[model samples]
Target: MGSGDGALNTPRWLRGIWVIPLAFLLVFLALPLVVLIIRTWSGDGWRILANASTWQITALATVQAVLSTVLSLAVGLPIAAVVSRYSFRGRALAQALVTVPFVMPTVVVALAFRSLLGSALPQGFLIVVLAHAYVNLAVVVRIVGSQWSQHDDRYARVAQTLGATPLTVFRTVTLPYLRSSIISSSVVVFIFSFTSLGIIVLLGDSSTRTLESQILRRTSVLLDFPAAAALAVLQLIVICIVIALGAVASRKRGQQKPVRNALLSMPTNRASRTAIHLIAVCSCAIVLLPVFALLIASVRSNSGLTTQWWTSINAIDSGTTRIGSPVASLAQSLQFALITGIVASLVGGCAALAVLAHRWGRFIALFAIIPLGISAATLGLGMLLAFGRPPVDLRASGLLIPLAHSLVAVPLVVAVIAPALRGIDPRAREVAATLGARPTRAFFTAYGPTLRTVMLAAGGLACAVSLGEFGAASFLARTGAPTVPIQIVRLLSRPGEQSYGVAAVMSLILIALTLVLVLVVDRLGRRNGALRPAH
Candidate 1:
């Protein structure tokens, strides 16, 4: 199929979609980093780069990230196997529950850990590693499970018939098949832990400090922009190296034979069935326990269980000193969510369309995801340096938070929409054009329904991201109007029963909102027929 037949002929106006995303990225994503580098170089940023402590922190964080990745893989692999390969009761719910912690605000996860295990475990390296594993469970399950579901178990069956033990079969057969996905997921989880901010800030000690935390302290506390910039540059270089390594590791060696579709089925033997169900139940419990603890903490106080915290969400004097009312923060979060949803959907939708409409569409799509590799703290600091000041002050306008969120969200929107757009048969547009429709009209005729569906799905996802996003918002959010995640963090920083209770209440609210947004997105995609089965 030629480009004109299989791909729509590029309309001049359709090609214009690239302009918005390009401009958005250039202004918000690229400009900040350039400014940061220039500012740092003008000062003593290079000296800080050579400081022994800087390299020491990088080394320590790399080790910590590796440990976290190993733990996440160990914990998440079994859950991924059972949920992805079997047809069991509540499988969808199990999958959804596994994802909750990942989508929850990092600060909330840190607090939940502190509430659940702070008394039991010391605030240091082990606790930090555990928290990192918890937050990245979804990365492993989603990435590995998607691949595992498509794997033909017949290979394992064939190996079993050849007298190979289950462990041996997994080691030689299944492991090789999943190597790329495993490595890819590991790199992602590692990057997240390595560049961690909220979890480290709450759970880490001197021994566990990551480069991200160092950058924050250098910028906000010490007022040393040069040092912060140097750390950011070092962190960015490390991130690039890790990503490059992942790309090298994930490259396919040879073309493998295609396999037939294998639908999920219940295990036949009693032992196997029991084992699978047990794993599923345990996975759910593991994910829900901390959340359950938070819920209990929100209600219970020194006197007894009470609804005071819930009722006092709106109270101005809700026991927090620096943080404002939870009610006001909630309102602020929703407003930001709305703006992020609109901006991300528009920019990301255009980027996705550009992939099909322009000659350099794939390059544009690739560039859009750069924000994923950039740490939230890095992005926040860069934005602070670029726009937080007088020449282009965005702080007072109330748009910085949403704009930062949109930057974080644009990649996800592209991920969700690009595939859906590709799944659409270009021949449909050709048919519409044959009926005397113009290229624009024909393009809409073919793609409008799926576009609307995925845009809404992507928009809801962006809203969810905005609700839980903490890193950039911490640097950018105004003092009087903190978001929910920021409010939760501030409340947790103070010491008091009422403070903890209110923080718990806010965390619960944030959790509820995030889950609702995700569920709605899933439902909307399913209803609109935009969700296709993976091959």
Candidate 2:
């Protein structure tokens, strides 16, 4: 690690180590794509894409995703407006609560929604759409809210002064300012909703079929690898098209920011202030209710509020007779999370460092992030083909999940560390040299503490991801070695109140663990000012 002019002067050993991340991406990422393409092109998979059901389901998923995106924007824009612009008491906590849903495992969120909306809303199109909106609220809030806080309000004031009504001012002035951010957030939410698997499985009916869910069905239930590969290809095409269109729309509108961020301001009138605070309060409630419901569900039973489920968590037969202890899934998830943490930190940290040191640094950084565009389900299936077989059996080695998760998480790790690394002061090393410190010691003086904090934070975030990850784990987890998310799904699929109670218990545990990891990441990231956005 180094800074400024010294950035390119990083140790040769560090530069050479960049190959580890590269080879990892190759073996896991590139090889998988090649294998998937071969399977798709060489088999009868291409003909499956021509089936009328394929396009029919794709059309249905597109409509569902569009509705989910619209609903998320409608809900999220209001929460973002209150949390980002109008500062008030508990503002930080409100923003933090908004993020909890996004980071929670999709499967866990599905169960929580079932707990919260039972009888009030049946599980189908409406509930699936609502659940998707709830889960994706953060994508809109964080992305658009960051941009919302930066734009100058003078434009709105001027429009109002010219006799525009409040709605007119917003439509004409504020909305234009956030066009790019809204488009960006919309694209992400749409893609997520379109590719949803866990939520769709738990909360959706035939009307809400997504290609992701279809791929899983074709693969496991039908034992139709060719059909699954065909679905994968179709899914990739749709995602690429959406991304391409989002890019075009964003490029056309562009982004317009104030020369400098405006100062944080609060509404002056009692009515305006009351409205903002009320909205903030409601937003927090919306975020927390499902979680609370999940908690209650864990304790509630036919006899009225019993502790039977919590007590049975450690029993050898907590799940279906074949699956062994439910506690075992937690242990498996933790073990995998730790492995993912270590692998992702090393690989992602190296990729970030390479950006400051190698001539092809930007390429390595770009290569690492490519996994973000690929679906976890797709990558898991690819890994299954590439490494779950005769030539190599990562499934047998129990490294497949960690390796896939590391690829999934490395981009986020790079995002966290690169800026912090670049922000370091190079002159610190020179000062250390003047103090007679050795070159290695001098480099550490410049970058050691910051790198240490960021890497730790990044690793924690990776661990949180592995803990809640469902799409990949659902596909790759051995029948008997289910991860927490997979186990939760299995529990929810069976027919009984005890099953629901036990599932809720496991979901709550996963949420607690994830929240703890996020808290640690936040604490570490704050040391370098990367966690919180400036007002």
Candidate 3:
């Protein structure tokens, strides 16, 4: 439509678009943080900061995070190069499957690792790093893969034609193109590992503890609110600084054109093809081994391999002291999932829309993502202090876990929706207005379809996130009303072959649930053409 047509159709409210998202950030993101800060400040918060153990944990967490990031990149970059840059028969499936580990609950991943490699490898730094790397593979693959897809292969070809060695061409051209994505994905992976709770708790020794774990210990184990708050502040500062650095690094790459889909090509040489196949097969095996182990354990028993675990899932707790029935955990987890999905989508969707509606949208959007920086344990602790008490005890109400999960998920929803909102053509609203649609109707006309698709996608993402979430759930979970992750932890804490086997079975179920949620979400996005190659 022409500019005049757009101007005539445009509504007055577009001028004040900032109000919605700002309000959202104020209530959901800003308020909780303020409460945390106040609680810390009210006590001797500064002394807590001076504690040597705090720095020790932070340093260790940083080291672990860095190592995890490196491993994820090393593993993910190759798979990304293959699936995004080259087409094979199962390329789409491969891409989707790689995201499985990321979406699975950290506890599930940790248990799977124990089942797979626990006997062979002790749980500590190495196992912790491996589990982290496995979980974060999707971040590297999706982010870097997006950039790799856009990489003009012809540039490498041109370098080769000019006598540049393959290694040199990659170093000079391909690496430079991927640098921003690398930095961004690295920061994200680092943050995840640094603030890790479930995996570290389940698979780590004292050396593997992060500030997140520390916060949980302070709040729940020690009942030291001030100390927990201080640790949370320190963690938030570190995360913000890292995120800022990533933003700067990404900006150095400047504006890049979105990549349209490119045709996939198979390797021409037998050696090159064999290498590609080897990498693909090995990557898949590495990713699936732990899950396979978990599956086997779920069905095995003392005599030998049996379907007893699966068969007795319904009756697993009939005559036992287990927290609840094994099957009951599934029902509890599903209920939480439903609540989390609805709440996060509404809150996060509003926050995203608020971003498009206001001048301060970027700030609000940034605030929404702050949960990514805060450890799940810290958030859980703060929520506990703020709401887990007698007068406002949400734990009894059965809303605390879902509420906490929603807090963690709001940022993801904003991430998914904001970029999509940016991609919508502003002129569409104008066109709708010119056709005599009301302002609100025009705005919906422009963004409604994409919003609908992304909201569901975001909701599914939130549900999947909540499904696998262990750390925060660990803090907020009541003794009698344990979620699956909580149940898994309880099972692991106990002694016996039966306990371990049952835990493994639960881990497998959790993994399957998470994978199903993610695949379904990916499928929806695909249907909406969101997963199609960008131009």
lDDT of 1 by residue, 23-141 (tens): 99999999999988998889998898888888888899999999999999999999999988888779989988898888888989998998899889999999999999999998999
Model 1 scores a C-alpha lDDT of 0.88
Error of 2 at 227 (Å): 1.5
Per-residue alpha-carbon lDDT of model 3 for 133-214, expressed as tens digits?
A: 9999989998998889887677778899999998999898888889888998999899999988889889999889998888
Better of 2 and 3 by lDDT: 2
Q: How many residue pairs clash (N, CA or C atoms closer than 3 angstroms) in each of the candidate models, in the order given?
A: 0, 0, 8
**lDDT of every predicted structure (CA atoms):** 0.88, 0.86, 0.80
Question: Highest lDDT among the candidates is held by which one?
Answer: 1
- Backbone-clash count (model 2): 0
Instruction: Give candidate 3 regions above 4 Å deviation.
Output: 1-24, 253-259, 318-322, 425-432, 441-446, 531-535
What are the RMSDs of all candidates, in order? Answer: 2.3, 2.3, 3.4
At residue 386, what lDDT does model 2 achieve? 85
TM-score of each: 0.96, 0.95, 0.91
